[model samples]
Target: MNTSLSLLADLLKTAQKEGADRADILFIQTQSVSYQIRNGKMEETESSEQNEIGLRVFLGKKSAIISTTELKPDEFPRLASQALAMAKVLPEDKFSDLLEASSPQRLSKNLELFDPTLPTNDNILAYITEMEEQALAQKGITNSNGSSAAYGKSHIILLTSNGFKGEYQHSSFSAGISVVAGQGPTMQRDYATHTTTFYRDLDTAKSLGLQAAQRALARLNPKKPRTANLPIVFDPRIAGSLLGHFASAIKGNAIARGTSFLKQALGRTIFPKEVTIMDDPTCKKGLRSRPFDAEGVKAAPLTLVEEGTLQHWLLDIRSANQLNLPTNGRASRSPSSPPTPTHTNLYFKNGSHSRTDLMADIKEGIYITEMMGSAINGLTGDYSRGASGFMIRNGQLAEPVAEFTIAGNLNDMFANIGLANDLEFRYGVNSPTLRVHSMTVAGA
Candidate 1:
């Protein structure tokens, strides 16, 4: 048995002796190294490792959680007893408890999450420096905001008093560069970044640097459009934000508290007939892939929206109990907090039309590539955000625009969505280029 598993089992026995009805524990160990370069020089380098353990104990209807980096075997008794004592005085929460159903009989197949090739500081520094140099080599590229390369690995172990033991490991490699174009007040900036489970899968430094430079050069001397209700095209880079809002609104806790605009919208048609969305925790080599969730529950694939209808809410054990629904195994947790509902690898499906075809009919619109601050009303679905991008004039991209606000109710926006066929899984929440019809654009 793993040393951590033995320690956790001992802690559970200690908790039982302290009058706890149930308990669960988590162990996480991580190692990471990163390098940052700017102006053709090494600006910073860091390497770190962490070992942490969290314990949660239940006393009837109450529970308490605590964490510590002290992994000594003698410390288990005090940590377990302290958690039980804390649980004794807490207010009763009828809905807070472990899953009554048995653990999944079988775990999912190996997801190939780990990459054995570790990164050396020397290699990372070289990689980042080269990335920055390439960006600064561009004609109009004035300066570099920064360039970075990083690699990390983490291992997790979970155990429960009622017989659940599981563990997994994952690795990550990432690189990015941001550059400025032009000079003085008219200068603009852009960045290109990519992350992957395997080091070989990362985008080349030359490609990323050039891409960032070109994007920044495209944004010089942006003009603000006159305020009007016009079609809005969301670039694939930023379109996933819409899916994020949907995830937040359908969190089981939000629905249970009646704080979500979509609280009462379940099973209804929330999007156009062609729209479909999915959440897959078991996707191979996915950024967020995991065989089981924080609470030792196996997470199967979930179709959140199918053919326009809202299919399910993201749910954990407590919220599912409150709403009288079966837990869908979406629980996520940290060392010192209780579990919460969250999605893993969420994305909308692609549509039949090309991006050009999707925007061909729009004479004037905004093709937003980036967004700023947010002002979303959960109960009302009112949405507004600062934005910057290019103008769509005569069915083609025109000069860049900035200092504008896009405003619309999410309910209306969802219904008006028109998707393009260019979808890629570059992010945990991915989407194709999409257009929303007739939204208010607040600008000069």
Candidate 2:
């Protein structure tokens, strides 16, 4: 047994002896290092290590949760007794209970989630310096915001009185660069970043730096368009936000509270027939992949949307009980919080058309590369946000544009979505280039 599992097992026994019907515990440890460089000099370096434990006790229909950073063996009895006392006073929550015990299946296939080789501080510093040097070497690049590299590892152990015991460890590495282009008042800034579970899978520092420089140079001088309704194409970098909104609307808690725009759309067609969205937790080396969810349920792929129709709501035990549905293993939790529904490795299926083909038919359109602000109403599906990107004219990308707002209801936008074949899994929530037939663009 893992050290954390042994500790949690002992704690659960103490809770039961203290008048708790059931209990579950989580233990986590994380270590990280980050280094940053700016203007040919090291700007900052940081290192952190943390260990936390959380305990949840249930007495029939009531439950209470508590977390602590103190892990002394003598403190376990006090912590368990405290949780039991809190549960006794809390109002009954009929939806709370431990998951039923079953033979827990360990991951048979290698997920490639961890890399044991830890990068030294010198290695990280070298990466940041190379990235900064490459970005500064670009002709139009004038200044740099900074370049950075980070590496981290996390270990988790979950135990329940119902007989579930599991442990996993994963590591992550990332590199990024941000640069300014042009001079003085006309300067524009852009950045590029990449992260991976395996250090070897990270993109080259030079590639990331050059990409940032080119993007910044492209936005040296931007124009504002006349206010009008136009075809809006979302670059792959920003297209994932659309999917994020969709996921939020389909969360089980949102559905139970009638707070989601998608509350009444279950089993109905909510998008074009060609659109399909999926949440997969089993992809090899996926950034968010795990053998099981936070609640001890086996993690599996789920089709949230299939052929334009809503399929299933993301759910955890509590939210599922609220809706009279089964848990779908979408539960995610931190040491200090209870499990909640969250998507892992979510993405839209790639479309058959290339990006050029998707935009070729539009005589005039906006290609959004970035977005800011949050003016979305989840209950009504109304979407509005500040945006910046380039203009598409005569089937080609034109000069950059900024200082604009794009507005539309998500329902209307989903119905008109046109997808392109440029999907990449660089982000956990990923999407291909997408085009919406028409939307209101407010600009000068």
Candidate 3:
């Protein structure tokens, strides 16, 4: 058994012995390896490993959480006693509940997660080299910001007093390029990347580099968009960003705590009938798919919003306890914490209109190729972001533009947004070209 697993079992046993009513133990370990290439040469290659264990114990309705990276045998008992002592002094709560349904039901796991002794560092570097060379070959391209690849093999274990115990290992990779394009007195730079759990699914380094090159080159002749309140088209990447805002409103934790901007708006026509959003943790070969969440509960497909009505909120053990709902396995943890409500593979369902047809009648509008800055407010759903892209004049991409701002409120945006058929799930979250009827487009 893994050291972390053994530590979790020992920690839980000791916690129970120390007079806790109930408790759960969470163990985590991660191995991260990375390779970076700069200016056509390998800049750095490195790896790191770490491990930790967290204990959550309940004394009456009060619970306390404690963690440690040290695995010494004596530390377990001391940590348990210390946690109980703290819990005893804390106030009781209505939402406090010990882990239950800790045992997971048998189900299919994400097969794409991990494999031992993956292709050596040499294999990854070779591919990165190819991508860099491809970008340098592009005309008007001079030097590069860099090309890089990263991989992580992470393992986690969960154990609870209610007889639930499970562990899983996840493998992931990220690759991309940053290129600089130059013309006589002008230079522009940009980057693009793809992250996946499987190595084979990544785009060729050359393809990745070329795309970055194209992005940089497109800015060479950016022109101002014709000022107007016309409809706009958002590529899938940008569309997905807008959809992400919806997740915050659907989070049960957020809604119950009165922190969400979407509170009390349930049961009403919140969005257009064509707009539907769902989260599927079991998406086959999906980058964000997982067999089980950070909490040891059953996970299945869930529609956050169906058509125009709110469906359900994202929940974890903590939030579920407050709402008196069943465990939805929506929990996830980083290297330093325990399970919390997080998404699996959340995305908007693709629509049926093609990009050309979607933009057919629009005489003049902007096609936002990229958005800059984090200007969306989670509480109010209001959004304002710096942007740069191309102008659609008479239904054709006429000129590139930059140094502008786009602003809108999410409520109004979703109620009137239109989705094109071109939506593709390039990531776990995706949407087609979306057209927000009218937004304030601040010009250069």
lDDT value, candidate 2, whole model: 0.90
lDDT by residue for model 1 (140-180), tens: 99999999998999998888877888888989999999999
lDDT of 2 by residue, 1-444 (tens): 356666778887888887878888888899999999899898998999999889998888988899998666798889988888888898998886778887766753577788987988888888888999999999999999999999999988888888887778889999998999999888899999999999999999899999999999998799997799999999998899999999899988899899998899989998899999999988888999987888888878999989999999999998999999999999999988888899999999999899999999888889999999989999899999999999999889998999999999999999999999999999889999999999999999
Which candidate wins on lDDT?
Answer: 1
Question: RMSD (Cα, Å) of candidate 1?
Answer: 1.2
lDDT of each: 0.91, 0.90, 0.79
Model 2, residue 194: distance off in Å is: 0.3
Q: Which stretches of candidate 3 lie over 4 Å from their true place?
A: 2-4, 101-104, 183-185, 335-338
Model 1 pairs whose backbones collide: none
Over 4 Å off, model 1: 101-104
TM-score, prediction 1: 0.98
Clashes of 3: 5
> What local lDDT does model 2 show for residue 93?
83
Question: Candidate 2: misplaced stretches above 4 Å?
Answer: 106-109
